[model samples]
Target: MTTREIVQKLWNLCNVLRDDGITYHQYVTELTYILFLKMMKERKQEAAIPEKYCWDRLRALHGEEMYRHYRELLTHLGTEAEDELIRQIYHNASTNIGEPKNLEKIIRSIDDLDWYSAREEGLGNLYEGLLEKNASEKKSGAGQYFTPRPLINVMVKLIDPQPGERCNDPAAGTFGFMIAADQYLREKTDDYFEVPKLKPFQINQAFTGCELVQETHRLALMNARLHGIEGKIYLGDTLSSLGTQMGGMDVILTNPPFGTKRGGERPTRNDLTFVTTNKQLNFLQHIYRALKKDGKARAAVVLPDNVLFQEGDGRRVREDLMDKCNLHTILRLPTGIFYAQGVKTNVLFFNRGTNDTGNTEEVWFYDLRTNMPSFGKRNALTEEHFGDFIRAYTAEDRTQVKDPRWSRFTREEIRAKGDTLDLGLIADESLSAYENLPDPIESAEEAIGKLERAAGLLSEVVEELKAAEGGNRK
Candidate 1:
């Protein structure tokens, strides 16, 4: 099925529970559980289920009998799963939006889907649309699971993942990077290309991920499986697993969660070098330790600008990163790019290389913030906005790059500045002056200039509005 068709079908069913105060996210989650159960039932009839579950016997009953047994099965399944995440899935599904009429509508809508066809075409698109709608809700805070698809595609293209290379996203929300990488490799290699030949190890062959949210993790698994890619995807905190070595990786693409420090139960890890509440720094340190020297490991980290210049342990971590690895590129992201409102973020790309005791050669910086044409809560971050970054990334050429969108800085230039501040782009004199503009000289001169400009702009706006009003009246 096409993306629109799938969206329309699911949306029609969404109305039944809209009155239950079920958010778009909750509706999608409930639907996901029911869909999984239905598919498992079908899979069992075709082949033996890998484990004993209600789905294995869900097909036995029909009509009211089927509904009764299904509800009972869900309750039983909720108790059987040991993982809190799994338990939550069944528990949430069994209670919320499971009113008889709503439950019947959900089951019937899910039943309408031909599992075989959905397995082939609709699954990935369906989940993607669900993610988009959920992010737009702006309440569930599930938007963190979604990175801009265009941004993800550009990063995957720049990294240019090869078949059989072990790719990972430690903060794999909805598995966007994994999906993009798999699609990239599939397109580049021919149909006859043997995946096994690309790598001898089959079981550990493809992509892997770690997601903290259980629902997101479940969606990530479904996302990967829909694409026919297979491997272990754990539902756990990536920061906890950071210092513990996983050998190394070829490419790591992630957009870790962003926000001010909030209290939560912290996970224990023995390998962490720095103990601070700053999660971004902790994740960066983790990625540093996880990369293999000379393995051509490159990562695109999404973080707020505070990590670039924050003092104390945050600044210390940056110093350590600069000394240990090659800090390559920084893409200054804009305000509305994320579902999380007013968030200022950037993408830091670096290759994990040998500890050669030399400063980073040239750090490429792309100022995409201003160049972007359209941005807002709903209509934000399209692929077009990222086109320049993709081209300048030079993924296909790999070496001998040229014509970058923004300028590159040297180690000396960075060192001259305090804390290697990744200040936003500077091009025009007016804008650059504002960024580097000194504070008012303990006088009102600078303040007067600011007020004058504000007055001038307001006057211009008033005149324009008057003219438009005059025309409308005529």
Candidate 2:
């Protein structure tokens, strides 16, 4: 069967294993272990069992015996690996699929996957789905790994990642941006064939990423391997030691972890050079330090709206970003794009440079969220939505541009706004008057307007429901 067919079939069988206590993530993680073992076994093309463990032991058993041995084998394997996360995953896998029947079913399901065909896009899709499933589980807050694929594609396109240009994602979650950047370069250039053929001009190192969470690290490793990329991911925090660890990158694409630091606990003692509770700010600073002199990196960072408007260190970071880097674009995202509820996000596209000389010659703000369709996990934002932004950005030629998400912002404009990085258009008089009409005090008067609009919407829904019900009755 095709890899898609196999993954879909296995995913469907997951329902049988799940009950009151079980979740989709547990089933998928368990399947990952089984799938890894099966692939390794297939690749070696030998029944020559390593002293560690072999699939034959579990494959030979049947029914209750098969189930019991499978669980025991996983436990033994985890202990042998001596890794705590591996042990937890295996133990959790056992708890998730407690029944022997379910265990046998899972084994057989993965056994159906075609490992040879799996290496191409097939494996990537399966893992992407798995990552999405894990994110939805929200147990480990894995949703952070998902950085809106559409946004990443736009970032990759604007940066125009080539083979020779080194790509890095510190605080890389699931390595989505790095992987996408790789794919973009491969598709655009002639060098890469069935497999990625690195051009001499194309960055030989290809990609590098840093991930802190153990499971995420494993998935990132697996993702790189599945894509035929080798030895570029590091299992550590990128913020604290990125300069030493990563050296310098041509392009750094990342969405650092969001949240303020507490007083008692900081990420590292010597790692953080600046003092502020905001971890994201520190990451931005680190990226500034990590970039080579005029190395030119386009980083698309997802930050809270506060980062654009907050005072103090937050203000300092924005000012520094504007001063030192080419603060080219800001795409304001709407609420509910994230699995984490009620998050309003914005993507800051900038590059590191030598001096704080020029005014932000042009800042393109793509208002995708406003007046755009309401989106959720079930029907999320896709690549098509970002087409305008990418086209507009590229038209600028990275050096000179007249028009495009493009608007020139003077230094005085920012200073007047208290050094805000909020790059929405400065409303002309008519627009400002229209916008001001929506003020909270005017909201009471606007309530009548809102009621009229809601009534119109409700009337439409009622008519649609009535038609459906009438059709059903007929």
User: Of the candidates shown, which would achieve the greatest lDDT relative to the real structure?
Assistant: 1
Scored against the true structure, residue 113 in model 2 reaches a CA lDDT of 63
Residue pairs with backbone atoms closer than 3 Å in model 1 (clashes): none
Clashes of each: 0, 7
- What candidate 1 gets wrong by more than 4 Å, as runs, is 39-64, 75-93, 113-122, 191-194, 199-204, 241-247, 264-267, 377-380, 395-405, 427-474
Candidates in order, TM-scores: namely 0.78, 0.76
Q: Report residue 363 deviation for candidate 2 (angstroms).
A: 3.0
- Report the C-alpha lDDT of model 1 over 101-191, residue by residue, as the tens digit: 5677677666776566655664666667766666655545577788878788887877777776678888888888888887787677653
Worst 10 residues of 2 by lDDT: 436-445
Using TM-score as the measure, the top candidate is 1
Which segments of candidate 2 are over 4 A away from where they belong?
Answer: 1-5, 41-52, 63-96, 113-121, 136-141, 190-204, 262-264, 269-273, 355-362, 397-406, 425-474
Residue 111 local lDDT, model 2? 72
Clashes of 2: 7
lDDT of 2 by residue, 250-295 (tens): 7888888888766635556255446577788878877765666573
